[model samples]
Target: MQPTMEFLTSEEAIQVDAALLSSKEKFSTRLAIYALRCLKQIAAEKEISVEAVTAQQVSDWIKKDENIQQQLELDSNFELFFTRLVLSSLKPLKQIAQSEQQPIENLTLKQVVSWFEQESKIRQE
Candidate 1:
């Protein structure tokens, strides 16, 4: 289920659109941004760092989230798809944040795109 997620605020969307990334990269950037926010919230609630948030914790949080629960009621498949998407997107952002020694939310679009490019080249090797 590719439900449209309004993860970014209007200002954030404008900033992302102004970046020089391609359409696909922009999508990834948005996912990373959203994942970062989720991570931040989870971390705060758990009293841990964003980098320390576990996949299990994220899944539990998503399941318990009121909005997500409402969506799940409307569509059974949303939880699986959205949970996977958020988890997969979080992978690169987590890596980038660790490599850069910054919080995930502090990562820039350029940093994320660069990480993806590196991963792509590595996969081709």
Candidate 2:
């Protein structure tokens, strides 16, 4: 298993938001929510704090290949579905985040909070 993160950066959250293709602002807000949930999952499984997520951890989570169609008795491959979604949605953020070369946990809290604050202002406008 890979190490996990405690939080999502603003850019990463945006990437997830874009991936969802949501039409409603409320739906788009789920990006941060889902990321935190994923971080919690990773933290629980790995016994790590959610604050120290790594690129590798996020990558590993995204690559899990859930295959939920098999679960629901459908003939479709949910694993492939998620794989494509991660590639299309996260690749750009992954690239950009890594280019900075700073620690993942280092910039996460303030940035995520700031992103939310900015969004809140926009929503209130």
lDDT for position 19 in model 2? 45
Q: How does residue 65 of candidate 2 score in lDDT? A: 25
Q: What is candidate 1's lDDT per residue for 1-125, written digit by digit as tens?
A: 55564668786677777766667877887778777778888988998877788778887878876657667788887877877887887678878988989888677756765676566567657
TM-score of 2: 0.38
TM-score for model 1?
A: 0.69
- What lDDT tens digits, residue by residue, belong to model 2 across residues 18-125? 542334543433444445556656767887765565556755785562533233244345445543443342332233235445533233433444444455566667
- Cα lDDT listed for each candidate: 0.75, 0.47
Alpha-carbon runs more than 4 Å astray in model 1: 1-5, 64-70, 105-125
Query: CA shift at 84, candidate 2, in angstroms?
Result: 14
TM-score of each: 0.69, 0.38
